[model samples]
Target: MKNKLSKLYKIFLAVGMVFSMCFNTLGMSVVNAYDPSVPKEFTRVKNIKYPEWWGRKIPSIASWSTYSCKYDGKWAFCLEAEKKTPASGKYPAQVIENNENVRKLLYYGFGGPAAYGEFAADADLKTAICPDDPLTNDDIKYLLTHIFLSGAYSGQWKGFDENLFNQTFGSNYGTNIMNIYRRIISLPDPGNGVSWEGNKSGNRALFKASYDKTNKQQVTNTVKLNGASSAEVNIPLASNVTIHIAGTSATQTGGTAKVYGGQSFYFTAPCQNSPSNFVSDNICGNGCERFTALAIHDGGAGTQAQGTWNMDPDDARLYLNIE
Candidate 1:
């Protein structure tokens, strides 16, 4: 009787252990299941041809999914997508739009989970600018031209007409426009021989004055010292300003050159003069004349002295820190 009881007890213990193992395995499988609603996989959409206006390549390892949610007491369909790199140095997240009116698709690349939340919140995501409306080719052309010319990153946009831009592009489109510009500007120079520099605003600002070499048609701000042996060029002052002077010679032949407002400051040309008889001395190359800068306080109108200096009006170009 004792032996039979032992056998039965062993059988019961073995069955209990097997049941526990199975339960734990099932729990782990449930916990590890992949949620299709969430973007978990990062596989490329194969054989998809991109549009010219897309401006950026589609990222690898992205997820596209649809969700149905209630909005304003009605069911609405929301599309959510995102992509990210396994490591850094991938493109930053961005939202792209295809505004076909009937079939709208919003592409979210590298935006991650937060972007998905924002996208999901918009029940009528098709109404959002850029994501649904998409930027027109003309809009892109205009923005690129203006940014390259006006130096958008350098607080130049501070003076821009915000109302007109908003009205033209829709609300908050300015930010999207800037984001595209930022991406383009961040790219390598592409051997196009163009370069950019950071402005006081700490943004990479294009040097419009560098690429466009044509002289201003109207020299309104210039103070020309034509054939003046000794004269001070009067500049109407607006606050404290730094004066830029371009001329044929680095140093005055006889008299001294100084800028005077409430106080006087002197500046020497850091570059050499162009070859004699050049049409415009503003060019600071081997055959072109050079310019220099001098700071002046706001006393009233400031004066830049030729001081018995000899140079032609065409031989010099003067500009102030007005804009």
Candidate 2:
């Protein structure tokens, strides 16, 4: 069953690929709206899970599973959980999480029954790596793009100890997404390579390159990125928001007139510069159609990152226009 966790990794990889493609088709210079006040009707949580051996600061030999929720037209929840590594005195378990829309898949009850039974029977699974953020947009955003850095362990086993290929997950979970994102999106803060389009009326987003989220989105669009190389872009707004979108060669949508609100409006690429291209001077990169985050965290504690391997080093920012 440990090997099943690998499948989770593959599924997330495929989802990310589709996100990139949608961005390409949407074109650059799209609006980046962020309103923590308006919830995206989605939720996410992340962390690195280990066995009891991990609690005693010892080595653990176990497998794990992960979960993901698509909100804001992208990933709302992306969890990478490690299953219990079996041993004589070892234990195992998995938390039974709940969601509204998706049905409970029968095979998703427990990861390992060994230590989990004892631990859960005693106090609950050993670790929960719950998000530090409250139930808000910021918290949800952080849960999906973070990575577990400590998963890589380094120490001598005994007196004549040698190197090993193990790791420690995170604090509340595995790693602090803030540190992870700070490292990934810092280089190309002004992202512009991707080109895509968002049909406001259809409430759909289609990427043109690396990332894709057509299947996962619920309301708004989510632009995903690989923490290490790619850029992180998050856009959160209300359903009636005056939003705008465009690509390098995209055609205009509703002209320059204000659509949603009286003064607030949404215009396509043909009329103005890429709204995503805005960035700082020194730390900013020489890219187009990109934006940096104003703050680091997603309302919770650490930076708002979700997946175990998908945390961005920077606060993937999404710039937008209201008026």
TM-score of predicted structure 2: 0.21
For each candidate in turn, give its C-alpha RMSD to the true structure in angstroms.
34.0, 22.8
Q: What is the lDDT of residue 83 in candidate 2?
A: 24
Residue-wise C-alpha lDDT for candidate 2, range 1-323, written one tens digit per residue: 01122555558658966876788778844443443334333433243332333334433333322333333333322221222111111111122223210111111111111112212224322223223323323332222222221121111111111123123443323334233323332322222223223321112222211111453211223222222133223333332222333222322232222111111122222112222321112121212122211111133333222211111223332233211
195: Cα error in model 2, Å: 20
Residue 203 alpha-carbon offset, candidate 2, angstroms:
28
Per-prediction TM-score to the true structure, in the order listed: 0.16, 0.21
CA error at residue 47 for candidate 1, angstroms: 41
lDDT on C-alpha atoms for all candidate structures? 0.25, 0.26
Please state the error at residue 173 of candidate 1 in Å.
2.8
Residue 181: error of model 2 in Å? 10
